[model samples]
Target: MPRHRQSLQLTRLKKAGIRSAAMLTLLTGVSGGLYLADNKADQEAASAEALFAEQELTEASVNGWSQHNVLERKVKAEQEAAIAAAAAAEEARKKAASTTSRKSRPGVTVKIPASCNEYSGNRAIGCALLLEAGFTLSDMANCLEPLWTKESGWNHTSSNGGSGAYGIPQALPGSKMAAYGDDWKTNPATQVKWGLSYIKSRYGTPCNAWATFQSKGWY
Candidate 1:
C-alpha cells in the first residue's frame, strides 16, 4: 500500500468520530428540555385538582350551615306558638271564673217564703230573707233547712253559751250581725238577712254551705 493513501484514510476516520460526539450532545439537551416541560405540566394538573376539591368542600359547608339555620328557626317558631297558646288559655280561664253566675249552677231550686205569722215563727222571716238574697230555689231551701237547723234550730234568738254566738245565723260576737241593722239582736228578719248574705259570700250558695257543714260540722 502507498503511505499517502494510508494517512488520508486515518484522517477521514477521526472526522467521523468528532461528528458522532456532537450529534449525541445535541440529542441529550433536547431530551432534558422535554422532561422538564412534562414535569411542569403534571404539577399544574395536580394543583388544579386540589383547587377543585377545596371549592367542593367549601360549598358543602355553606349548604350544611344553611340547613341548620332553617331547622333552628322551625324549633323557635314552635316554641313561640306553644307559649302563645298557654297564655290564651290562662286568660280564658280567668274570664270564665269571674263572669259565671253562681245561681246559674245546675240542681238549684230556691224556695219562696210563706207569710210571717205567730205560728210559723222565724221560718217565714228566714224564707223572706233568702228570697231577697236571690236564693229562690226549692233545692236551696232543702240545703238551708239542715244547715240552719244544725246552727240555731231555726230560732231567731238562739244563743251559743261557749262561743257567745247568737241569732238565727249564729253570728259570732252577735255584733257581727249589726252590719245588717241595729236590731240584729232582737229582729229575726235582720238576723236572717245577715245570715243569708254571709252564706252567699263565703260558700256561693246554700248547697255549697250545706256541703261544708256536712264535712266540717259548720258552714
Candidate 2:
C-alpha cells in the first residue's frame, strides 16, 4: 500500500507543475494519506490552466501560418522582377552589337542606295523622281505616265525645239529644278522631290492634272 501511495503522489506532482521539493515539504508536515488528496486537488486546478494555455497557443500557431504564406508571395514577386531585368539587359546588348557591326563593315557608304542613284543618272530619272517625291507610285503611273508619254515620250532631256518647254515633265525653264537643291541636274532624287512638290501645288496630283490636260490639252 505504501508503494502504491508513493506512485500516486508522484503522478499528481508531475501534473500540477509542482517540483519534487514542494511535494516533499507537504508530505513531511502531513500524513501520507492527506498529502495524496491535496496533491490530487492541486493537479486538477493545474490541468484546467494548462487546457486554457494550450487553446491560446493553438490560436498563435494559426497566426504564424498566415504570416509564412504572405512571406512566400513576396519572395515570388522579387524573383520575377529579377528575371525581367535580365531579359531587358540582353536585348540592349544585342542592339548595341548590331549598331557596331554596321559601323565596322567595309565599303558601306551612307549615300543613297543604288536603287535611288541608278534612276538619278537616267534622263528618264527626272520625271519619275519628282512624281515619287510627294505622291505614291500609283499616282505616277495613273496621272503622269500617259500624259508624259504623249507630251515627251517620257523624256528627261526632251526640249521643245518649238515651244521652249524642255525636259521630262517639262517646266518652261527646266533650270527651275534648281529650286529644290544645287544638284538638281545630277541628283534625280532632288529633282524628283521638287517636281512632286510643284505638281501637288499646281495640279494636285498627276492624275487630276492629267484629266484636265486630256480635256483641254494644256493642263
Candidate 3:
C-alpha cells in the first residue's frame, strides 16, 4: 500500500465503523465517487445480509437450487484474500495502480460437444466444461452462480427484465450475442462462452463487479 492508500484505508476504517483489510482494498478499487458514502452503504448491506441470511436459507428446495448464500460466503473469503495480498505488499511496492480490475482466472469446466448443433442440455454440459477450463477461478461459484440465478434463472432462452439484455449473462442490446455465435438464444454453451468473455473484458471476475455491487448497489 502506498502512503495515500494506507491513509485512505485508515480514513475508511473510521467512517465505515469496521476494520478489515478486505473492505479497505475493495473500497479503494471501487473506481467511483462517494467513497465513504459508498462504503457505508456496503457495510449496511453486509449487516443486513448477516441479519437475514439464516432465515433466507431454503432447505426445502432440492437439487441444490440457488445456493446464493453459500456462493456469497465463499466470495467474501476470496475478497479478503485479495485484500490481504494488497496489504502485505503495502510498503514493498508503493502506490495504487489506477484500479486495475481483477481478472477472471479464465477457464471453464463443461464437457465439449462433438458439434455445435447438439442438444440444449449438451450445450449446457459443454458450458460447464468451458467454465472449468477458460474461467477456472478458485472458489468463484458463489460470486457467479447467484448473479446468474438472478439474471437468467439458468435458462438458456432467458431474456432481459427490461433493457432487452439476453441469454445467460444477459448481455444488453441482445445483439452483443452476435459476437459469440449466431444462435445465442438457444445455445447455452455459446451464451456462457460470451458471458465469460464479457466478464473478463469488462468486470474482470464476477467478484470484482460483485464487490462494486456491494458498495454502490450496482456496477
**Candidate 1 lDDT, 12-42, residue by residue in tens:** 9889888888888888888988999999999
Each model's lDDT comes to 0.78, 0.65, 0.63
TM-score of each: 0.45, 0.38, 0.40
For candidate 3, write residues 68-182 as lDDT tens digits. 6678788999999989988879844543442221122222234544542333453345335445545543314556655666667767778766678877677787767665666
Where does candidate 2 stray beyond 4 Å?
1-132, 182-191
In candidate 3, which residue ranges exceed 4 Å CA deviation?
A: 1-134, 137-139, 216-219
- Where is the poorest 10-residue window by lDDT in model 2? 105-114
Which clashing pairs does model 2 show? 129-192, 130-192, 143-207
Q: Model 2's lDDT to the true fold? A: 0.65
**How many angstroms is residue 177 displaced in model 2 relative to the true structure, after the best TM-score fit?**
1.7
Residue 191, candidate 3: how far off, in angstroms?
A: 0.7
What is model 3's C-alpha RMSD? 46.7
State the RMSD for candidate 1. Answer: 10.3
Any runs in candidate 1 off by more than 4 Å, and if so which?
A: 1-119
Error of 2 at 179 (Å): 0.9
Give the winner by TM-score: 1
Among all windows of 10 consecutive residues in model 1, the one with the lowest summed lDDT is: 102-111
